[model samples]
Target: MRLSRRDALAALVAGGVGSLAGCGAPTARSSPSSREAAGDAAETPVGDHELATLVAVAEAVYPSEVEGVGEFVRTYTGSRVEGAGSYARGVAEAVGTLDDYAAEFHDIEYASLPASTRRETLEYMSVDDVAPDPDGTEAQRVRHYLVNELLYALYTSPTGASLAGLENPPGHPGGTRSYREGPDA
Candidate 1:
């Protein structure tokens, strides 16, 4: 099913992930393969609960677990190189560090809120009032950050790529450039 942001957040809260960092949600982003799972286990600094939260949010955004897409993003994020660290941090901060926002808007510890409340709060935040544009102001900055982070994280996902018809690496033996040859060519 298509999970709205509210739905995702609700799930997160329900899973007892009221941690300061927001790393306690259920997820559907399974390992692409045994090898990948092993690799992730070895590489990820975040614990399983946090990983699960990441996966849940990602799947909510993309919903393509069977295809190994969500796993790929999570694995890539764990590496913390190639700007992933900054990207992930910004995303967390945008979401009000998960805990801070939950405390302020939801009026409960991030972990204490009920699932329903989490979803409602998420819906409350996904609008212009909660996510305003950048204007050298803190609130606007947070809003802009959340909007950009969510968009970037989701749009760069495999499901997002599939939706846009962007061929994956393995699909093209040589590379994308080879397939991009125009009809004229």
Candidate 2:
């Protein structure tokens, strides 16, 4: 289900998330796999609930418990060496918006909403593509940090190479270059 910016803003307003003073809401979301679950336990500066929100969003994007794509992204963001702090902060903020929306709308956290509803919420955000308020809203924040940026990081990184099934990813130290052969001759 797509929502135009106006519709999305109206929906968010109806949900009452727009009235929130700050992005401070508790949320419950599950890690995708044993590795991610383990990753989830490692602890980071980002709040546990906030991290869970990130993981939950990841699950929605990849939908694979074993792949742990989202968890991997989380790890990548943390270890990024330069901008990790900024990325983490942005995601934490977006998750706050999501949690607030969920709490006010369904009387449950966004992560706790039924899977279909969670997906719809994300779809709504993707389609709307605008913040509900002057300063900002969670939907736009989530799309920017979690959806677009996170996916870009995933698909463009060495980790994305694994997902794409490359024998030697773009910049490995000493791996064979297989793509030069081209499709079967």
Candidate 3:
């Protein structure tokens, strides 16, 4: 049987993936208004090229059944990178590495490549085989900054959580009734 997105998400949630929810909520500083209030208006949140590449990565990594991939990636990644210091730098470096690799081999930007080709390029980079590490090898960094980041964003979102049969994701408050009822109720 073909595993649908819900099936995969449900399996992950059943396997204690909820613990990964410790990735935490976006801070106030991540908001554009807050950044402007803090006098950081001059700094760009995330580069266009980098964001585009990230969107492409999300498309390749996220389950095809997930809708609004572009918007979700932009909102999630943009907030995560804004005023994020070292994390933002890491994301930029990772996207650059992926894009450069694509260009060298495919003669085009990673974001411009077809979806299947993008997946193939990631496999060629061996991102799946590498452990996610910000300071490790090229493949590791890509896994950390691109692949893992997107997964984290998706699984933590309300829509994604519901796919796994979670009515409320961590950090999001369930209603008062939720406390009175079981998870399945």
In terms of TM-score, which candidate is strongest?
3
Q: Which candidate leads in lDDT? A: 3
lDDT of 3 by residue, 1-185 (tens): 12235433443444344343224222322223222245343464357777898989988987887877776676556655665455665676677778789999989989999999998899999998998876677898889888988887777655666677765566444446665677768
User: In candidate 3, how many Å is residue 108 off?
Assistant: 0.8
Clashes of 1: 2
Model 1, poorest ten-residue lDDT window? Answer: 22-31
Winner of 2 and 3 under lDDT? 3
lDDT, residue 24, candidate 2: 27
Clashing pairs in 1: 18-110, 18-111
List, residue by residue over 1-185, the lDDT tens digit for candidate 2: 11123322332333243232223222333322232234443343255565566556656765252264445544543333122233444555566667767777788877677766876777765524564321244565577655654454444344344455643343333235565755342
Q: Model 1 — TM-score against the truth?
A: 0.40
Question: Each prediction's TM-score against the native?
Answer: 0.40, 0.54, 0.71
Q: For model 1, how does the per-residue alpha-carbon lDDT over 76-109 read when each residue is reduced to its tens digit?
A: 3333212223333333333334446667876754
Please say which candidate is ahead in lDDT: 1 or 2: 2
Quick one: ranking by lDDT, best first?
A: 3, 2, 1
